[model samples]
Target: MDADATARLLCVGDIDMDLIVRVPAPPSRDGKVDGRRIAQTPGGMAANVAVAARRLGTRTRLLGAVGDDALGREALAALTSEGLDLSHVATRHGEATFFCVILVDDEGEKSLVKVMSPAFLPRADEIMAAAFAGVAHVHLTVARADPGLAVAAMARAAGATLSLDLEAADLPADLPQGGGALADLLASVDLLFVSDRSRAAVEPVLGPLTSEGRAVITTRGRQGAMLERSGTRTQIPGHRVPVTDTSGAGDAFAGAFLSAMLDGADDATALCRANAAAALSTRAYGAQAGAPTAAEMAAFLDVDGVRDA
Candidate 1:
């Protein structure tokens, strides 16, 4: 791969340990049910996306905060094993690492319960202009306001395309009491990732985000995904795969699609690549385990009549 063609990504967001349990159904009130299986893995929107990009042969850097605890060490080790640049990952004291409990039902539906640790200090002063050199894209999960805004500003000033995962539910509590802040953020983002669940909250503020130049990509789980751009909408068909857990499928799709775009792929081709990755990610129990390599992606896409658009 040509180094210049593909972007060196900078992913700024959250990291957590995910405890995934497979259950037959929600337990009856005051009742107990046995879980089919349990798996503990690294999971967080921003961290998952960075790992996905790296697995697909993109140079990626992950910047986030974690506590100085056992879970934090484990999460850091997991990310380091994936070969992501973690020089920017901050370690804070007096707090435990964040984590989530994910329950997956028989139908592959997931319900997440997250616990956030104390906020880490802002790293805006550490963000140097030189850090963006040769970086083609900056991806953010706006779980907190300060860091996200700082990174967005730096990415823009460095001439890199800016992307955001609208983690609306996790936005900082201190943000101005209105949707105005969100609307302003949406106006400048080049690519936006919104889950089907978040589309309602986002659309009411920004209206339909698709326009002549900006693009808003929505992930609809098994229904595939839609790319809205240039006043047009393109349906990227979903691939059928044996579902294990749907924990990080959307994050995988976002990372793969952005990496493809940085490599100069057309919208259709990028979406195809992303969809293939997301589909393949469901074949395993954990988010990172199912992330496909470039070779795996090619093989998956080569089967049957599948072809790049």
Candidate 2:
């Protein structure tokens, strides 16, 4: 698998409109804070990752649900502008499009409030069967409804490699907490991307992962990332960049990493490329706006010490 080989990537999960605002600082009780600026953009964990993959020179397709409203139209337009295949995106009437309010503080940390449309969360079996057709890789951003498991299973059944990112914070108490159900899902995924915070929450339920055909990656913001497969563990250090927004850094990393892997890059090379992509994403104010092109990422990699694990 040469780095230039064409790879078809199918992304499944949330699709939404984002309202990103930069504020001086978070307001305290009875305190007043002024926002610096506001920008509306097409975003959603899965959608952002798809855009990142496309920017990195991978053919990408998106499968998700949205309302037949103005926001949904805008999101579709954005994905189209990026050359993402949206033929499978379903739109329903009488439902508002999913959206999120992202507030970035002066320190570059972010807080998000997400509002989902009732029409979202398509039938997992239908969406998975259609999206997995002829795809080389499948990446799922865990939705509030936990659609990734079914999608992953389908991808595996089709002989396509599967990747998963756990992005949702809310889960039903009765459901397998953390990595219990997550570990079971891992049996089908070739790669797993999760936050370090999430690792702690999930560690208790995680069983001994049989890395027969799988790699597990946990990202520690600023500290870089860790990769575990089989019994081997490797830590890749983070890059230093003037941070503007950390909103979509993780999503960018996941996309870049998958793209690199599809290009036949080894685990270390993939982590390095992913780290550079994530670092570049923080140099701007919005999620997708700051994602660098392949040339830019390559140039950044040329700088010594940027990728030294």
Candidate 3:
């Protein structure tokens, strides 16, 4: 497995307008303070991962929705410049696009508030099994479980590897506690990315997925990441970098890790590459702005003494 012009990878989920504001500290309710800066950028779990993978020279595509509004147009333009295939993306009429307000504090920690549009719940007619044809890998930033199941079924028929990011899913609120339909959908994936904060809540339902022959990578912010697979687990220490905003670091890690694995990198090598990419992503303010290209990533790895594993 290697990335080339024909390496078809698809990311399915949200695409939003991210309004990022930098503040000295977390704001209190009904209290306001002058912000250092504010900027609008394209963001969303699937969109960010698609951009990250594109930065690594993978042939990536996005399958999601946005409103037929200016914000949606802006996001489309940004993704287009990044070279992601948007043929399957939908434009919903009479609806506002999804938007998120991200507040970054002095420590680069963030708090986000999101507004989702009706378009976020894609219509059944919009999903087509043929879309998965020839795809080598399919990643879902699952906000809705049903669509993910639909896509996974298609991916399975196409013989593509399936991957998932759990943060996008509305978890405990939407799924049954004792491992229901949602758990079944998650179990079908080849790779799973979970944040440390959500680990405890999720572990009970998913159990040790790696022990079942699936790869699970846990993202632990500044502490780096850990990979568990084939009954073995390894901790990949995070790199120390000048942190600006940690908004898209996890997305960077997921995308880079998937691309590395597709490129035939071994477990340790892939985890190291992912950590390097994620640490480098924190050098800038917005999620997509700081992502490095393949060559840039190679140089970063060399400088950081993580050339390959």
Candidate 4:
């Protein structure tokens, strides 16, 4: 647990399986459209980030829970094969695992539907100082307030940087949109990742969110991403590739971005690398399927030249 020996990234949030379907185009309400199930893979923002970071040559740890159901076993099997430290993952016996159904169009745009189970949330008490041993950064998808707060406090205490990604579930009646409470929560975090769809969730209180030493990254798909810091914004262009699915592109970016940061890469350089990693991940059907390794990422950047040069 020596400080200098710690080079791991941590992800705390959900883990579930995804069923991907490729449609001619997304169907309108009540409009039947024929499609094919392209793949069923392990997903969930936290899990995706962990896999992506791990592939990019960082030791990663995943702190989440899964049900004891078949889907949970499958998801655990996939994750176990990916080589992440899941020693802290909880097993909710008799509970059903969460399921995500992704509908990707021929154009690669995707809409997702989540089937939630009564799966348990890993309580804050379950998180321990040992879990932060040798942990450098914690990428978190905001879950229940107590657990999220525990993670933030412990991560800060470990002198590890904190990153928060707000999912749709945290928009209201939840953590991200907690107004003053949200600002206080984010005060301890170092980075924030936002998708275009969740942009408005923090727009109203963005000022306070970034007032301290916090930075915000908004993933804009093909256009790449934007980094906001101290009221100024830097635009990072994306690499263009034949996209197969856009489901986990943003999560990939989050993972690679953290990987770069852990390597001591600066904001701009990290953004470029992360943008490229995200573009490469879309070359396959599942989120983790096409994630690039460290060498692959390096080769991609060499060819792509770290932005549209």
Q: Identify the candidate with maximal lDDT.
A: 3
Which parts of model 4 are misplaced by more than 4 Å? 1-7, 173-180, 205-209, 307-309
Off by over 4 Å in 2: 1-7, 28-32, 143-146, 173-183, 205-213, 304-309
lDDT of 2 by residue, 1-309 (tens): 133433389888888888988888777879888886678988888888999999999888888888989999998988888878887788877888999889899899998888866755666545657567778998988733357678867787778887878543744455564455656666677788888887666555554443676788999988989899887887888887899999889989999998888888888888998999999999887778888889989888887456523
The Cα error of candidate 4 at residue 286, in Å, is 1.1
Q: How close is candidate 3 to the true structure, as a TM-score?
A: 0.93
Worst 10 residues of 3 by lDDT: 1-10
Query: What's the count of clashing pairs in each model shown?
Result: 0, 0, 0, 0
Residue-level lDDT of model 3, residues 136-202, one tens digit each, is 9998887356787788788898899999887634665655554577777877888888888777667
lDDT (Cα) of model 2: 0.80
Q: Which parts of model 1 have CA positions greater than 4 angstroms off?
A: 1-7, 28-32, 119-130, 171-178
Candidate 1 lDDT over residue span 21-133, tens digit each: 89987677798878865788998888899999999988998777788898989999999888888777778777788898888888776778887676333367656676676
lDDT of 4 by residue, 1-309 (tens): 122444488898889889999899888988989999898999988899999998988889888889998999999999988888888888888888888899999889888888877653566666888878788899888634557788999898998889999655454554333455565666777898887767765565444345557898888888788888888888888777898888888889999999988989888888988898899899899878988998888888888766422
TM-score of each: 0.90, 0.89, 0.93, 0.91
